[model samples]
Target: MNGFLQEKPIKNFLQSMDEFFSNPFPNSAFPLTVKETTTANLIIAELPGINREQIQINVYDHHLTISVNYQELITEENTQQNFFRSSQTYKRNSRTVALPYPIDEKKVKASYQNGLLTVTVPKQKGKKIMIEES
Candidate 1:
């Protein structure tokens, strides 16, 4: 009786983990590189087999978020045996970065080429505010 109770929880845990890993985005994190320059910060991410339309980027409260989702469909047929099979695969990932210093979000730029994503964030210039003597 005790063994049955313990086995149920173990099976449930394994099933949950399988469901979590089925979607690669939240389970696996991709690799990236960041470089800082005098005027701007550059970020490079490696994303192979992904199209520009499958990716999304957003900046809010000094944080930059990059997300991507791609799907591929495959179908196979056997004429002699009269067999047909169809399968689908999906790849996804998301990454968020925190800027070291304040950035000019309006001036930020990004580009994707050769399976690499590059983002340039320009630093915000300090504006001097004049104080009047009372």
Candidate 2:
């Protein structure tokens, strides 16, 4: 069956091409390794120079997003300067990951340690999903 009268999304072929050209150099996302546990999916992100206190995690609209914000101090020692130059820089990065299925938001657990952020999203106790013939 042809989708002649059905409403389409806002994205089209031209829009996709425009978006790709607009963002030439994409930002490097957090290096993450996702694994399935007994009850949940575990995602570990390797983010250096991120403070534990600055890590933010939230669950919204059945989606989970984690943002990390921190500052790194860089001191120039050999720069031909009479005084040392120290600069503090701030960077913020976020990642949005969807669960395999609907999950209990209250059971989400996240922790950060040694520049690594670990997240545990538990699987929901769900009813048997069945498809019926129309």
For each candidate, what TM-score against the reference? 0.62, 0.58
Model 1, range 19-119, lDDT digits (tens) per residue? Answer: 87886555477778889899888988888877899988888867888898878899999999999999999977789989866656789899999999999
Give the worst 10-residue stretch by lDDT in candidate 1.
23-32
Report the CA-based lDDT of candidate 1 relative to the real structure.
0.84
Instruction: Indicate which candidate wins on TM-score.
Output: 1
> In candidate 2, how many Å is residue 45 off?
0.9
Report how far residue 108 has shifted in candidate 2, in Å: 1.1
Whole-model lDDT per candidate: 0.84, 0.77
Q: Which stretches in model 2 have alpha-carbon errors above 4 Å?
A: 1-27, 71-90, 129-134
Which candidate gets the maximum lDDT versus the true structure?
A: 1
lDDT of 2 by residue, 20-112 (tens): 898755565677788897878998988777677887888875678888776789997765665777899987778888875765778888888
